[model samples]
Target: MAGKLNEKVLLTGRQVFWQDTLQRLFAKEGWDFYVLTKDFPAPEEVFRIHNVPVVLYVLDSQAEPKSWAPELNEILAMCREHGVRRFYLLESLEMPEARLELSEKIASAWRGGEMTVSFLRLPEVYGPGAAPEDGLAADWLEASQRGESRTGFMETEEKREFLYADDGAYAIFRTIARDFAGESLDIVTGQPVSAKELARTIGEVTGKPLSLSVSEASFGGRLPDSSLVRAEIGWSPRYSLKDGLAMAYEALQDEGESWQRSARRDRRINQLRGWKEKLVPYAENLAGALLMVIVAYFQGGTTVNPAVYFDLNFAYIGAMGILYGKGQSLIAMVFSSVILLGVLLRAGANAVALMYMPEHLLHFVAYLFVAVVTGYFADARAFERQSNEWHAEQARERYDFLRSLYDECVVVKDRLYRQIVNSDDSIGRLYRIIRSLDSVATENLFTQAAGVTTQVMGVEDIAVYVLSKDGYYLRQKVRKGRLAFQQPRSLRVEEHDYLKNLIAEKNVYVNRELVKDTPDLAAPILYQGEAIGVVELFGLDFNKWSLYHQNLFSITMRLISASMGRAYQYEAEAQDKRYYSGTRILREEAFREILQELMERRRLQGEMPLGILKVSREGRSCEELDSICGKVTRNEDFLGEHQGGIYILLPDADEKVCNMVMERLAREGVTAVREEKML
Candidate 1:
């Protein structure tokens, strides 16, 4: 009966490859699926698609929230109008808050109504080529593999939840088929496993004894609980963690060859295109030259004029004519007239001066004709050379531009890959940045700005700060290093003097001694619109500033400022709902209490604050308090996982802490120690 239901599902947005896979998975489950490639489609066109009764919006978290909201509403309206009863909102695990809000909005639209709308939250899905450094699951797996037994606040004993790609697809299909009354379903494995356990399972599957050295600090956030999902859908995952790991590993092995083959194909295509472009002009010029030579031969009366040299003169004129074709008509005509005039003058002069000597007169005429012919050939050859040179110059310029673009792309790709591999919020931020920047014409302008500013300011660190409701935050569109800051709290832009000036004046600011003088400037810096936090260019040669460098810096500053403004607007609009929720969340003492407990746990495990803290000698004793220190290190675990905090790993237990803990540790004779934590 379920297989017979003539229902069609529509999936939309970027990452077409993933969407295509999902479509295939759906077909395997007996339902027809249609994918929409555009970011947003017209409501009428969407309605016109044949056989698609249900719309499954697999929206990218980084997509423009405002744009998607209206599109979603319109689709829902169309679904309602067409008597389509079901709508499902599927979200990935990166930005839970945004997903939660989207779910709530969808629920509100359908709740107590005839149509059925529900939200499904998927766990980190893994497949072949799955490494902790590539996908969300891979990020967690990588962390567990790297930090097995190290004591740090970021280190967690709690297990993570992961769903295989197929398992996740199956779960979604099952949820869509099931008749449920709820507004949300967690499409995940209901089992909870610790990081250590997951690592062991991966090691077992790979046959590699991955010795994990866990720092007491827990760097990554905890997985969301999916108990609610299991209860509502009456669905359970078929694959266990071990089974999923094995399948993922096998898939990666099979896909390795395919990935290599695709890369080689891409290289070959590029090479072929380059060769085609090089040969096109040469072919055109050669054909044009041959035609001109034939025409000149016929114009010379097809006679062997040894005395008059008419053939030579005609050849010169014809060659010159073709050469000048690429130029202005006026220029070609002027050169042609000059050649004809010179030939006629020489012919007439010899004909009159030595008329009695027929051989000498004939020789003069022949010489004039030969000179004309040679001149035309020389002109044609010169024009061809110039055309080729110009073509090569243009190609060189284009190649340079493309090379620079490729470098920028590589930088962005690497940054995105790192974020994906780490499963960090920066991934979400970067995705948003890319989406927002996609709408702009000057895509590479931001990167250029960062490079120029770094050189001009003579500062290793530069960051662009945009004014937000809660102060200023560094835009993470083009980050250079690991992101340690949260959206609002981690990257406080109000502290930096240069940033403050930039924001206030809406202009560029240059500070040479930023590090020593500006104590509040953040690292992995943002310059102009790019996130080039800190650049290490040592041994500065103070050469006289050239106009080129100056112009580059000036242009970069403008571009950065413009990009930052656009990014700021996009983020501001996207975060409005979150900003309100954040205010409420922050005001909730329960949330804070939970956060405090987690921070204490992190401290005990030795996880320091997100940013680097230069602990002064005056505060050195604060490291020695074991009881208070333990609470601090362990606080991270209690803080709901996502809240960033400090950790303290005691090296030999002699580290100082708060006044109370310092006195107690001193009395206990715990003098020297070592400790570590996850940031």
Candidate 2:
């Protein structure tokens, strides 16, 4: 059953490797693409939301049919119920009869409905992004890069065709773009390569020995015929075998380099430990021996009986034993005994005669006893400390590894969320942009204008300026993206009369006249044929400088203008209720609603910078507080009164800007602290 297709595409599968590449291609071709993963809560809800005319069900041959078949059938039936009449079942030719079983199942599931199912049987797909277990080529490449021999890993004498990931994605993209359906097509390269040939080619590309043994006489099932796909969809592989292998090899090299860097860091740490263990104790022993000799020299002949003075010698020996282990302590004991004998000689006592003295003998025995006892305990303590350190190191390493994994998971989840929710070319993005400006508060509208302009126009360097009260200047209220360098904070209308007049006439100004410091595109945020503000696009890709993008910029500015006009009208009708009687500061209730709206916008926009500063009254009257703060705040800044405090909302502001605002308030004798939890 052939039917007209919509601009939406729903891609669902067990493991879809080409989803990202295909998403980019679809976005470029003006299609709203959505992915329904196995973990998604409700398939029926997605089907209803997208209302796509086509569904792409990719079948992973490696997965057991029993695991995915029932779910696939249920989804197919749901798609039929949701007005999806076209389906393309992307499968691999390596699977034997699995394609037939799946196709038959889909047919049975949609028996009473007008369903058109097409099968695109692909060859072995491999590229840089392919997982190691994806195919034989990827597996072999992984083993070779890991310095592993694949000599007998899988002794198959078969020649199989392989398709690069991008090429396969392009084939499917063309099929969908051309609306080709209801037919089985084999998508592959014309020539098939044997395992030996593939192994050698990968070896050459990666500069590593594959060490694989492939049988000379290769045999395999019939290769897929790609001529039909080529003729119908005008698709062909853009990468040759060598070129594809090279790309994969380069990617593997990048990963290998990172691993090598980590390995080298570990080696350096181990070397430092080796030096500490082997050399540090001997250095300590030498320094301790020298200190003992110095003490012996200073104690010269102070005691009439040198043997009695030798009591201090016992203390030195015991201290050395406790500090160093048994071996080094014994060496230090020998040095101390020598120094004591020299001191005795200097005091006119014979060494042999002193040995015969009972006190002297007792003192010598005490020295040996102290050294042995203290050294043994010291050794035990050292061993215990080392064991504790080892356990702590292990625990620390485990904690660090777990933290790294958590951080990686967070990054991957954020990336996927961005792709699905905030993709640049989806209709949902446009809808979100429009909805962000739907607030009737003019302050809220101005707060959201910069972000919405950047997101919709796909430009990084943008500046928003509002027309000053007397129309003397367009003062810069908000700047988004990379305008970090110094730019003028104010633009005098007389300096740029051309731009001012054009914007007054409700026309967008492109930088075709070569005005210095002028943005690439500037449009008026018009309210009743008068310019209230201007949105300037300072930078964008060259491809966006054409008539189409200029027209788009013009239209986006008009949308913002209309929203601002409506907000102004609403403000006039309920000014006193929304704000305090004399100031631009909002009341408590209106402030709460605005906070909720801004937070929702932040969440949807991937956590755009939103800073809230809380200014406490500190026993001052509301009138006095407002009078002081109003002079320091910008027109774009949102000031709200709540609970005897003033909360200021600064949109698209980071720490630097927040600090500047705090400083200004400090100069005015007002205390303010950033409310981090409010965001």
Candidate 3:
């Protein structure tokens, strides 16, 4: 084996599980490894901090060659500046352009042959959380899992080359350490293991009978030959088909503690709980209004004018109902104005009919006055009914929103529990816990915001990104699910195709083309007071033109921008406090104390629950403080201070109870700032 190289390694791109496992394995063998994430601290900063002498580039098979080429060049330049003499390209599969371009770049950079470049191509890897069912083993395992027959692609009938994840990590380390004397190596066992035999092994391990049917269709695409790898790196897989299957089976059995599991549990609960129930009566009422309109159209009375009045009245009522349900005062006013105009016209026609009679005209005038009053009362009644229905709809919306908020809280709590268990260290761990907790809270808020967009603007997949000095970072503070951030290599925001077109024009760009070409782009997301992102929605019926859509988009944008602004201020203040504290001790301790104080004050002031508790120094637990605080406080005084003191402005509390509570807090050595007044 070659001696280990004294260098730090930076890993990036998809295959997080692979990267994480590699980092762990490398560290165990005394190699410094740093995992580069598309999240916080930015990409270039990762290079600046570690400045590793050797660069290992991991390429995914699906990545665009045009995009990857420039990125590779950038990484190469960075490596050159750091005095790196060697670059290694690790790939799962070969893409013609990516392989050719990368090799050409490496050769150009090493004109004198003083620098070395190597490529390691890996075969099918099987372990825990690994299988073709997951798309990585698309040629074999995935097909088998789907009960499809496949044929062997290789010319040899009994080709055998399979490696476990741990073994692969070990092999990579060994190859790098020796600086193997070859330009390319096949990291595979030369033994032939047929596709049929491998499927049977997996079936036996899973206890799920899988039939292997091999046909000409399966043998269409041949695996890239790795003869160069075998000759150069001296790499050979130790895990056979049976051994790899056994390990994978064990891993699959123990994969219950992942984020996917938690998400699945949540989805199941939502399906079974039956809690998003809407009041059926209001829906029925709207249906009835619609039915009336239909009936009025069919029932042509003695005169067409009377039938017209009935149709007009039905439409007027339905319009009022819709406006009321949406809580739009302007729409309701417009509807009422149209109906009043119709009534005035009808009255004027009746007056002209009674103009020739003397005795009969007096009776007609009296009836006309009575009809006008009746019309006024009828309009008032419709308004009242619509108003009541609106209130009911609002209540239903609020209930649904609260229920969603509760479910999200539960998920956040669970994530926090896992984070706490996996974390190590006091200050850093605590910071992580706080950050995670903040993220959970933020996700809930963003979800609510998304709900608002959906309800008001009929948009889906709303995402908010906060503008940062480096670029746009996901406002994880108000997001749901496993929020991931993507850092653009350049600071020019317009480079992104979607954002580029949106920012170029200062108005909402409705792309009919998006619906036809990219239907997924329909979900509208607002940012910086405009609709920055939108995806085409399915099953939308646009029968009428209404300003409500524009209003909804505008309002959603404003809300998101304001929320992002607030979240930015918060993160900024936190970073500032960390910077000014100087000593790590004072900074960390002060932060914790500040957090605890904020929690307590929020509890007293009935502010929204925002903090998580540490089970140990490293682990965090979500605190169910929603039940503790009956209502969220919107007041500023409770959140303004850095210390952990409760300030009560008790104007409504009973004097005796207030005094008693104050005395108890004092006894407990808790400071309280209070203003006493008679209730």
By lDDT, who's the top model here?
2
- For 1-679, candidate 1 gives per-residue lDDT tens digits of 1345656777654352245457777887777787765423344455543536666776556565775677667667767655566777776655457655864576466544456777766656676545554454454444444444322234566555677776777667767777554666667576766656666676787676555554564434336566666676666778887887777666655676687899999999999999887665455445544544454455552223456655343443344444443332223333333343444454464534455776645644654454455556656788789999999999999999999999878866865564464331234533433343332222233343334454343433333332333444543322222122122223455676665554555433334564543422222224344443321222223441334434434544444555655655654565433222332111233334333433443333233332211111223232333233344332211111123322222211223443333344345553322223332
115: Cα error in model 1, Å: 0.6
The per-model lDDT (C-alpha) reads: 0.49, 0.77, 0.48
Worst 10 residues of 3 by lDDT: 613-622
Q: Candidate 2 — which pairs collide?
A: none
Displacement of residue 376 (Cα, Å) in model 3 is 22
lDDT of 1: 0.49
Q: Rank the candidates by TM-score, best first.
A: 2, 1, 3
lDDT of 3 by residue, 1-679 (tens): 3586656766665553456678888888787887666554445556655666566777655566666667666766666544566677776533455565565565356433334666766665666666454333323544544456554444435444566787788778877777764566667655445655666676776566565443453322225455645555556667766776676666555663465788899998887665433434345444544544454445531111463443344343444344334323233333333333334445464545445657545533433343344445656777888899999999999999999899878766755654454333234433433332233123233434544444444332233333333334212222211111122212345434544565445444444443432222222344444543332223233621235554445544555445645654565567556423321212344444444444433333232234221111112111222112112221111221123322333221344545554465445444343442211
Q: Model 1 off-target regions past 4 Å?
A: 1-5, 13-17, 39-41, 48-51, 59-71, 92-94, 97-102, 129-134, 139-153, 199-234, 249-256, 259-679
Q: How far out, in Å, is residue 360 in model 3?
A: 44
Model 2 spans > 4 angstroms off: 1-56, 74-87, 98-108, 111-117, 129-132, 139-159, 176-183, 194-218, 295-679
Better of 2 and 3 by TM-score: 2
lDDT of 2 at 153: 25
RMSD of each: 29.8, 23.5, 31.1
